[model samples]
Target: MPYRHAWLFIVTLICATIFAFWRTYFSILPEAAIGFHIHGLTASLWLLLLLAQSWTPHHGRIGMHRALGRVTFVAVPLFAAGSMAVIHSMAGGTVGGDPFYALWGARLGFIDTLALGALLYAAGMALRHRRNVRLHAGYMLSTALPLISPVFGRVFNRTIPGLIIHGPQDFPVFGLGAQCGNVLAAMIALWLWRRDPRFGRPWAVALGVIAAQIVGFETLAHSAGWNALFLTVGTQPLPVLMAFGALAGVVAVWLGWRLPEARGRPKQDA
Candidate 1:
C-alpha cells in the first residue's frame, strides 16, 4: 500500500474531528468560502506531519524523512499554538451563535494540547529506542494520536441527523450519537484485543487502559460533577480527543507488534 493508504485512516480521523467541532463548537464554512488562513495553515501543517509519518518501501530514508521530520518536530508546538489561537479567535470573534459553540472551542483547545503531549511522548520513545521495531511502531502510533476523534466526530455528524428523524428523541439526538460511537469503538477494539491470540499480554493491558479511558471520558461528560469540575479546571479538550487517539493508536500498535518481522519472527521489544 502507498503511505497515503495507511494515512487515509488519519484523513478519516481529521474529518471526524471537524464534524464534531462544527457540531459542538461552530458550523463549518462552505467548502468554497474563504475563511481564516491561519487556521487552514495550522491544520494543513499538522496534516502534512501526519502524511510524512508513513514510511514507504524503504526502512530508512534519511534524505526524504529526515528533512521533513526536522520541520515537523519544530511545528509540533506551533500546531498546538496555532490551533488554539484560531480556536480562541473563533470563539471570541466568530462564535456568537451558540453558547455551546464557545464551550466546544474551549474543549477543542484542551484536547489538542493533550494530543500534542502524547505525540511528544511517543516521539521521545522512538528516539530513545531507535532500533526496537515493535516499540518504535507503538510509539509512532501513540504520537500519531488525536487522529481518532475526527473519525468519531464524522460518524456522529453523518449518522445523528437521520437517527433523530427516525428515533423518538423528541428533539435531535444531540451529543449522544458521538458519545455512543466513541464508546462502541473502544469496546470493539477491546473485544478484538481479547479475542486475537496474537496480540499477546502487553496489548491486552494497553487495550484495557484504552477502554478504561473511554469509560472515564464518557463518565465525565455525563456526570454533572465531572462536567462542573472540568469546567472549573479549564483543562483543554485535547485530553478527551487524545484519549480516543491513544485508544486507536493502541490498536494499531497491537497489530504492528503482532505482525511478522522482516526476519519472520517476533521483533525485540523496546
Candidate 2:
C-alpha cells in the first residue's frame, strides 16, 4: 500500500509548494541575493529529496534510500538556514514591505523554522526503530504537514480576488488553512494507523505536533505580546535560531544511527 500511494503524497507536496510561490520565485527580473532564491532553491531541493526518498524505497532501492537519508542530515540544516535567511532578509527591510508586515513575517519565519525542526527531529527519531516501518513512514510523510499553511496562504491570496489581509488581525485565514492541512494529514495518518497497529504511536506523535503548531501559531500570530517579541528581537539576526534548529536535526540523525536496533517480529498491515 505504501509503495502504491507514496508517490501521490510526494506529488501533492511538490505541486503545493511550487505553485504557491511560482510568481515570486520565478519573476522575470529576479533580484540577486534577495533570499527568495535561497529559500526557494532549498525548499525545492527538499521536495525533490522527498520524492526521491519515496521512490527509492518503493522501487526496492533500499541502498539508495539510506544514501538519500544521509543527504537529508545535511539538507535539513541548509533548509533551516534558508528559512532564517529569507525571514532575516525580510525583517531587515531588504524586501521593502511595510514595517509591521515585516515584523509579522519575521514571527511567521520563526514559526516555520521551529516547525521544520520538529518535523525533521521527530521523523529522524522514528527512523531509529527500523523495526517499526509504519511509524517511520508516518513521521516521514507527516513532516510536510506543517508547511502547507504558507502554501495555502499564498495560493489563496493570488487566486482569490481582492482578498484583503490586514496585518496579524486577518491571520485567521492562513491559520485556519494550516489547521485544515493538519487535519488532512491526520486523516491520512489515521487511515494508515487503522491499517497497521504499529502506526498508533507514530500517528499520535504526528498529530500532537500538528495540533501544537496549530494552537501556537493561531494563538500568537495575532497577539500583542507576539508582536512585541518579534519587534524586540528585531534586526538581531536569528542565526542562533537557525543553528538551534540545525542542531536538532543533527541530533535526530545521530540518535537514529546510534540507537540499538529493536528485536521483534515485524509488524505488517492487516
The positional error of residue 220 in candidate 2, measured at the CA in angstroms, is: 2.9
lDDT of 1 by residue, 152-265 (tens): 644654566553423223223434553455455555445544554352332344444445444554454345564344344333453443344445444433444345434443
Candidate 1 off by > 4 Å: 1-5, 11-40, 57-62, 86-97, 102-116, 160-172, 184-213, 221-270
Estimate every model's Cα lDDT from 0 to 1: 0.46, 0.63
TM-score of each: 0.55, 0.77
Off-target runs (Cα >4 Å) in candidate 2 are: 1-3, 93-103, 160-197, 232-234, 238-244, 261-270
User: What 10-residue stretch in candidate 1 is worst by lDDT?
Assistant: 165-174
What is the per-residue lDDT of model 2 for residues 240-261, given as tens digits with 9 covering 90 to 100? 6557656766777777767865
Compute the lDDT of residue 8 as modeled in candidate 1.
Answer: 65
